[model samples]
Target: MPIDGLLLNKLIREAQIFEGEKIRNIYQPVNDEVLLQLQSGFLLFVLKNPSYLIKLESKPNMPDTPQNFSMFLRKKIKNAKIIKIEQLGLDRIGYIELSVIDETFELRNYKLYFELMGRNSNILLIDEENKIMDALKKGVSPKRSIMPGAKYIPFYKREYINILENENLYDLNQPFMGFSKISKNLFYEYIEKYDYISFVSEFLDNLNVYTFEYNGKKEILAFKPVNFKYDEFQNPSEGLLNFFELQSMNSRFLELKKRLEKTVIKEIEKYERLYKKLKNEEKEIREIPDLEKKGRLLQAYLYQFKEKTDFVVVEDWETGEKIKINLNPLKTPNENLQVIFKKVHKLKSKEIHLKERIKITKKMIDYLYQLWQSIDFVEDIETLMEIKEEMIQEKILQDKTKNKRRKRSNSKPYEFEFNGFKIFVGKNNIQNDKITREADREDIWMHAQGIPGAHVIIKTNKKEVPMEVLLFGAKLAAKYSKGRYSSKVSIDYTMKKYVWKPKGSKPGMVLYNNFKTLYVEPI
Candidate 1:
């Protein structure tokens, strides 16, 4: 419903007058409005910093201090005691007398000569000098117009009320024919101040008393005022009682107003928390590319090492036979190390992704709680469904349809040929298992000591293995292990017969004796 001027006037008429009330507190919720708590037994709210409007409502207790708009009112009208008040213009305007110090001042006046022009809505307070003491709202300072220092001429004309003083009871049943307007429009224009139900009730009563009819049917039958005895209307229909109940129920709409206010507060808190979490996660995700670049450099280094052309020395364990195996860089140490580090980087990226997912989950929890509190009907299940869809879109809730079956590709164990001998290095778990169980007893096995690293082996086919190739394989072992970045890593080498895996040892873990420790830093 539109808040008409008449309704505001009616409210002012009903407000209790405070003759000697003091301005105890004031609050300014916005630039254009002020709420004043007076020492009088009323809570007064003054609106329109641009136009003059004062509203008063009763409260059980007065506030100790001003809040929001009340603070501004105290500053403007300090220590002024109210003396007298007069209602004018059908209670629309109120003029007040005040006693300030020893001077009897008549300061408070509500008949503001105000104008709302486009974006410039201003309320000018003009004194006898035609000088504006202050304005509730400010307009643009024009070069040619009266401003802060200039003489004030009325910027706009004031509205005057014209009352129909001659109309009497006889005029009420004349179908308002003098206006030459539609009956509905005329009735509305005359009785528009009342609410819809009240207007309908009053109009019907007038029709019944006047024997007025529309299309040969009576529109109104009876009138029922707030204090009317409903039981006296014998044989009342259910329809009439239901209509009365609807009107009565509307008086309690203030409960819904309170619920709306509480919902707004909860939504504000939820949004703030979600925004903070997303901001932090965004910062973390931005660092992932840099880590990926580091992984690329490490992969390139291992690739180059595996591409060296040499004969790998291999030692047969059972027959003590040694032979030379030619090494192919693409299928040897370079390829194996590249694959191992790639898996490591992938695992690290997954960890970061999981962390981000957890953050989103927490935000969703807050959002759901807020949603539940704000909405009235649980039957509208679409809101919950929308939240689920959002989670899936953000990848917080994984989409099973997007999970593709991946074929596992195996990288053969690391091996290279140097000086007519065979050598082998294990890159990862599956490859380590294969290399350890398949190598001959005569082959020399090597691994980083007391560290979880790659397995290295040198084949001796009845020919003694070269020390340089053995050292190179040992260094490659250390480079691929958990201690790859350490200053010096220990690598033990022995015949394949001496190196053995226990029943269920983790890949690349083996027990060995008759081994030599080689301390090497991987190039």
Candidate 2:
């Protein structure tokens, strides 16, 4: 599940609890990942360098962090004093004030900020110097906004306040008028913002005493009123009323709050560890080009070492062509070396992609969790399929089909009409080939430039194509291609007659002349 608002609230509460604590030690486990130890008596509260993000994380593993950012954190803000901490209203924005001295004899105040990790992680540090020390995000700047050098500006506008702080639980039974109007969205909104569902539930359970129930032969509807009784012991016969009594007597609210806080802390720790591991693994993988060269050198050495008698002549099976094949008794050492090299290369590539996938997957999971917490929607197979397909397109998951082509039907092709023009998109390579061959010369054809993407054709029917229709076709082509969601993609468009598939070009590979390059960003 995505990290809910409750988890964030709990983290904020914990941060508040350790607000004025003195910094004991600070160290970076990986490049950007800084660990801050705050001493509150004997217990230490560790606030991870907020700049480092937990990209991909598993339950039993550490999350991955970006390399350059981690390095930046290690270089700067090492063992800096955390002066003051403040929560940004009810949202997941938390500001940690830090004090650091530069080369000149002067104390500089910096605010280390943390926003929730979503589509982007927006943790940043801004100093009194009015310069950006660093940011978890490299995107966006104060200059982009109207307010420049604003000390306390949030990354995004604050929309709502903490629900608990807004609602008065003390005067629960005042009128009960507002209580009945609370919808599921409001209930979940409160649940997300205040990590204290047990408290809310307990409060409601106690307030059930003033609840009204109506009975009828038809469908029976019930409305509950909020009631709070500070004094006088009531009978424990009422169902929800008794629950409140037990909750009050056992003082489980405090326990639940503690549990929630611990869970948030543990999640933060897990993310921190995963971020460190991923960063290190990525560093290792980035060294593969050098490793590949070394492997090639080793292969050359092994090949020469067994050149005397170990090599043998072999004939090709197709034509009985003679070829020198290494047949060392100890096995073709060079061939074996090449095999190992290939395996290493594959492993390195896989490791990098896997890390990226895991990171994206974690983000998606966190998103789903948050959505689930806010809504009572059941995640079905269709949603999972869409998510899987998205992941595959993102290269987070390997496409199982690879280069395989599906058989196409010989029946009439499916077509869509938009803006008084027929739009035909190929279902597969065979269909694409048929469409290109059979379509009128005047029809406009479009394809993703220099990539194995879909075939899109706009049936212009010997008429001048409208600019809007051309753009529509281009957008659709870009949207379906590998470059979909990218900032800019080049799409090639031309007359259908000018498009031809090369004799042995792979499926979806085609040559086109008199084509126009359309620079477009997909919708």
Candidate 3:
């Protein structure tokens, strides 16, 4: 839910908990978000769509290279202590009064204003005289100038009565300052269900905010949401942070999924082109024998062709058939024979090189396809991060960080319980390697046969594995495979002892013996 003036008012009041806290650090995690690490906790001001400010419980990840606005804020108020935090006239505008030591070794006062109007939201730094120093977004408009050196103009005021001060005279049809449309509607519902006096008393005394599901989506309001189960919080800031952080995580997950899919698809196209070219070169190997035969024919007929000519007729020694050999008229017959021998030698060498290239290219195409299919199985941002980290390690994508060491992910395999057997399915190549390596010798292993797919393992505990459980595992393997949409998929299964990863092979690639195939529909 978008933050209205009332929500911003509640947020500003809750922000007072960190009034005297010193600024420990500052960061711009993305272009639209800024995180303030206070001595007490982390404060974030998101200035993009659905903008709001809250005190986070922990610090979020920071980019290695800071944005220009973040750099400016860090230089100006890295260690500044908050003098005060206030909301302007119950509007969606908030300012933090901070004091920091200037270059002259004296304390200077500055205000950071957070304008939380969607699409027009901005965080600006103001001097004591209220002149704009810099803004998160610099712009020029007819009503206001958000550029440096321009005077800071607060948003146009609307004459709405304060509901707390004039609750008896306030009408639902008239504007109530700071109250959102939802809040206004809730006020009418409350007055109709109960009485105005009790509603006013509760509104003034309420210190907690509630969050609930409405229309299958989460929403937060100052008053208790009607006809829904809700979670209550004494502090509004924490509630807002928890609710929005979850939304942010889901949004970030979807964005990363689309980006990874695009990257993998692009890589697949590139490798497919390379694969086709290499295959075409492989066709040239078929001409090697013909070139050697031509060289031999030229050697035998070297004396018969005395004059410079483009063609010479000869008899094939092996087939006893007449053959015409094309020659380069600029050279002698021996020179032509030498050229044919050179052509034959070059083709032979290229044939060896082409074979290796074709093999590697086809493998790459298969790997990229696997990564593409694996993206659909990703359930969280951490899984996407793991996939992205894998790409960076493989040099398929460049690492955006500046020489920063990435922490290794410990993402576990997806687990399912069926018919008293525990089935573990790998989500990505790394997990595939882990699942197979860690399984017991007698545990059943399964995969989609002749296709890029997840590795499935059933922990047998040295018990006799049932046929039904094996079929269940096979269904899972097919579901996660590239052939997921097929009516039926072939799944190969064997004991863990019979499956072995080949030396110098790619991740998730393995060779197996004593395997049985099962044809089953994807689960």
**Candidate 2 segments whose C-alpha is farther than 4 A from its true place:** 22-34, 39-71, 74-76, 129-131, 141-153, 168-523
Best by TM-score: 3
The digit string of per-residue lDDT tens for model 3 on 425-456 reads 99888888889999999999999988889999
> Which 10-residue window in model 3 sums to the lowest lDDT?
163-172
Model 3 bad stretches (over 4 Å): 16-46, 55-90, 94-113, 123-138, 146-153, 157-203, 211-219, 302-322, 326-337, 388-405
TM-score, prediction 3: 0.76
TM-score winner between candidates 1 and 3: 3
Worst 10 residues of 2 by lDDT: 216-225
Give the Cα RMSD of candidate 2.
25.3
Question: What does the lDDT read for residue 145 in candidate 3?
Answer: 92
What lDDT does model 2 reach? Answer: 0.51
Question: TM-score of every model?
Answer: 0.33, 0.29, 0.76
In order of listing, the candidates' clash counts read: 36, 12, 0
- lDDT-best of 1 and 2: 2
Candidate 1, 514: how far from true, in Å? 66
Q: What is the C-alpha RMSD of each candidate to the true structure, in Å?
A: 28.6, 25.3, 5.3
